[model samples]
Target chain A: MQIELVYVPIDAAAVLSGVKAGEDGAVTVFDGIVRNNTKGRQTRYLEYSAYEDMALDQMRALGAEAIQRFGVRNVAMVHRLGHLEVGETSILIAVASAHRGVTFDACRWLIDTLKQQVPIWKKEVFVDGAVWAPGEPFPAEIALG
Target chain B: MRLEVLFFGVLRDRFGERETLAQFPGNSVADLVRYYRVIAPELGELWSSVAVAVNQQYSRASAPLQNGDQVALLPPVSGGSFRNIHAD
Candidate 1:
């Protein structure tokens, strides 16, 4: 079980490492990307920041929950802080299990819970301006203002 | 009592990179914010605009405080990127 918060150049190398660790039973991975458009504006990039201390704790809890609920084996999740451009993998989550079913279930739960609970916030930088990306409890993006 | 306070992003720029001791008659989150305002007025002006977390959970200014609480003050953030994002 590994949950990390790092500031690195985004790439698939981490995913490859995850796959190598599990040795091919079953591995599930998901990458959250920066979209080109948001709220009718073109998004150039995003700035992600976190209250590192609590953000890390929340991530660890989600990983533990996945282990308990899905009975999955090894797992690795990493999220990059600072800035990122379009098409980058802002967050990566991978779950491994002896069978594919457990891996799939755990993977879904990990991402689902992350979106709902993680303390990290993403600000979408549009072509002309910017906006604060609301978080879990508030979820401003989903609600009409 | 004084607790270690961490300021991030624009907040850091406003208050500068130094931890100031915040005195509280009662060690609660409300007192912390009040001390912050007394210490840095620029920070105080921007306080309500940003979000806060106590220990670790996203909390309000009035959240309860503990003896060794690791309090972080975060400004309105522009969070993380997808994959092919730019460098800051």
Candidate 2:
């Protein structure tokens, strides 16, 4: 299991390589990249920030949970922080499993869950202006009064 | 008691990265939220939806706070790419 929040670019090839094992039959990957536009507005770039310590803790727990819940052989998740240009890789997730079915399920779950739970935020810089992308509300269990 | 309060995302934009609160009278996370609301009335509605972290852990409003504890105010997180059709 590997979970990291990096300031530099995410090496997708290296992350995939690290998760693969001889025992694994399938290695599923999800590569999330920065896009150049939002709601038809041209984006110049994006700025990502995180509550580092808490984000890492949440990520580590999710990695462990993915392995046990999906019965995957290995899981590696990495998210990049700081400035990112369009088309740059923003996040990468790899799940190795004995079969392809579980690997796909695990990979999807990892990304979806991370978006909702992880303490990371992104600001989209557009030609007109910049705004913090609205996020999904926290799950009721985590949201406090 | 002095508490180190950290802010992230939009909250950081509003409150800066961190602030030191001296002689904090609040004893719990909720009290801290209430105090913030009092000071920054413009952010009154925003406070209701935020999640609190005490010492880097997810904490409830009622969780008791200690002197010198590190508290964080987190707005909703938007980490990954927005998956709307136009986003791609």
Candidate 3:
């Protein structure tokens, strides 16, 4: 299994490769997109910036962990960067395994772990000309939720 | 030795995109935080939510610092788009 960190359109990669299901095999894919709203406000677009080194290291580590934890082989991941309009694909993950169970399990772990650990910052630029970025303000209740 | 650390996102806006030279004492991430606390007290309140990277790699805030390493300050993240199911 291999993992890649890049700044590109996530949708292109997600559908670029189609994994074939071997006899008794299965494949699982997941795609994360830019949504139209956050909390209750409308969003215009998203800008992602990365702490490249740390983000790659963490991604690689997560890939290794996924392979070891679930007997999943043949994993691919791609993340987008720069400015993206709403409803655009931002991240994509694909996995192929002999069975469906392990594949789904591995795919889930990769997505959840990446969201929590990656240094990617998604700054929501709203229609009203306001931008809400990480490492910025929000009430304690807002920050946690 | 002082390693130039670049700022990004909110940190960049708050501290500016300019690099900051911080002297290393080879301490844990916590120690570095403390050092920065003394060096740039304005950042103290925002420390907990911030993340750090050394030479382009994400590291634990508890990780020890090394000389000549390029450190970066990272904020939070969000994104995940699964493409397909188990196959091949």
Find the 10 residues in a row with the least total lDDT in model 2 chain A: A132-141
What is the Cα root-mean-square deviation between model 1 and the actual structure? 6.0
- Give candidate 2 regions above 4 Å deviation: B84-88
DockQ of each: 0.20, 0.57, 0.27
Candidate 1 vs candidate 3: which has greater TM-score?
Answer: 3
Query: Model 1, stretches more than 4 Å misplaced?
Result: A19-24, A138-145, B7-21, B30-53, B57-68, B73-88
- Per-residue lDDT of model 2, residues B1-88, tens digit only: 7899999988888889999999999799999998888878887667777899999988889999999999999887888765532223
Q: What is the TM-score of candidate 3? A: 0.77
Alpha-carbon lDDT of model 1: 0.66
Q: How are the candidates ranked when ordered by lDDT, highest leading?
A: 2, 1, 3
Interface RMSD of each: 7.6, 3.2, 10.1
DockQ of 3: 0.27
Best by TM-score: 2
Cα lDDT for residue B46, candidate 2: 70
Model 2 lDDT on a 0 to 1 scale: 0.88
Q: Write candidate 3's Cα lDDT for B38-78 as tens digits.
A: 66667665666666666775567667666676777665544
Q: lDDT value for candidate 3?
A: 0.65
